[model samples]
Target: MNTNDATRATAETMPDLFALASSMEDDMHKVSDLAFLINDYLTRGDRITLEMQQALCWPASELVEVGRKLRAHSVALYAASKRPATLLNEETRP
Candidate 1:
């Protein structure tokens, strides 16, 4: 299809795109909440044992990584929405 057709098609899918973005944002919020909880648990006055703290360290780090990835994806999605022609061209490239 030509550029106009491609752009029109992208426009038609805008609602779905927005929904997906919204879902991603919700997921990011949930991830943030979990990270906050983990941080609170790890930092709260010495109620937990050292072993428990050590066990949480890895998961906490993983959550941070996940949050970063989610944020990056969200930004990418926003960028794509702002330039549908560019996104369409990139997708169809061999």
Candidate 2:
């Protein structure tokens, strides 16, 4: 690309991060975007969708595993849409 584009990119970018705990919170989105790809493609069976991959907000690989917990959420949405609720208690929620 042109030097102008390079200069603009460099000027707009944040400083390099050495550790997650110490890194600026604002860069989470960029880091999480990459983590999503790693989880979605490198992982198999019941992978998180792109929409979810973007919603975690914290933007970290450890956080991306939240997809595993979303199984109940997906089931709940499906149950809510079905003809009617057949069960009660915890079953009704999930």
Candidate 3:
């Protein structure tokens, strides 16, 4: 298939699979950390306008979904990194 057709097919089949599969751990971690930093700002009575707050608002469900995906990706990556390559091939190893 052509590039456009291939892209369309993949998107149609898996939707956001690429996003869910890619590592966003660092970015997500920064977001989580920034939340704490922002709390400090709020504690200092730094005004966050209603429009700004509205712009920053994210749904809990969406955050939960991304967090879950990121966690699963991290676990898979850790296992792949720590496990012996020999164990991946049963016939070759044993």
Candidate 4:
């Protein structure tokens, strides 16, 4: 219905921030491991096959896009956290 109602509904359905942060941290570690492995392969003096190149390219691009989204989310969350609760509630009210 109204903006306030919509915001309340969304908040009701949102996941716990602590759990989400933990999961994200775990995923980032996995990504870091993947980066280390890729770096090792690149520096090991072994020729990279076309298939390996193709596989890495897709994930690298996806990672870049994911990183952009993560950065945007982090910035928005930080900004929201800095604002007063009254201000946030007023902004959401219709």
Give me the candidate number with maximum TM-score: 1
lDDT per model vs. reference: 0.58, 0.43, 0.48, 0.52
On residues 1-94, what C-alpha lDDT tens digit does candidate 2 reach at each position?
A: 5888656544433121122223334434544556645455336544445564555444445444444434444454444443222232234344
User: Each prediction's Cα RMSD?
Assistant: 8.5, 19.7, 12.8, 10.7
lDDT of 4 by residue, 1-94 (tens): 6899767655643433333355456436544645645554445434444554465564554555445554555665566555545565666668
The lDDT ranking, best first, is: 1, 4, 3, 2
- Please give the lDDT score for candidate 2: 0.43
- The digit string of per-residue lDDT tens for model 3 on 1-94 reads 6888656554543423334345565546635644644444335343443433444475544444544565577676565444443343342343
For residue 57, model 2's alpha carbon misses the true position, in angstroms, by 13
Candidate No. with top lDDT: 1
Alpha carbon lDDT of residue 80, candidate 2? 40
Which stretches of candidate 3 lie above 4 Å from their native place?
1-55, 86-94
Look at candidate 3 and give me any clashing residue pairs: none
The estimated TM-scores of all candidates read 0.42, 0.28, 0.37, 0.39
Q: What is the lDDT of residue 38 in candidate 2?
A: 43
The clash numbers for all candidates, in the given order, read: 0, 0, 0, 0
Model 3 residue 77 lDDT score: 55
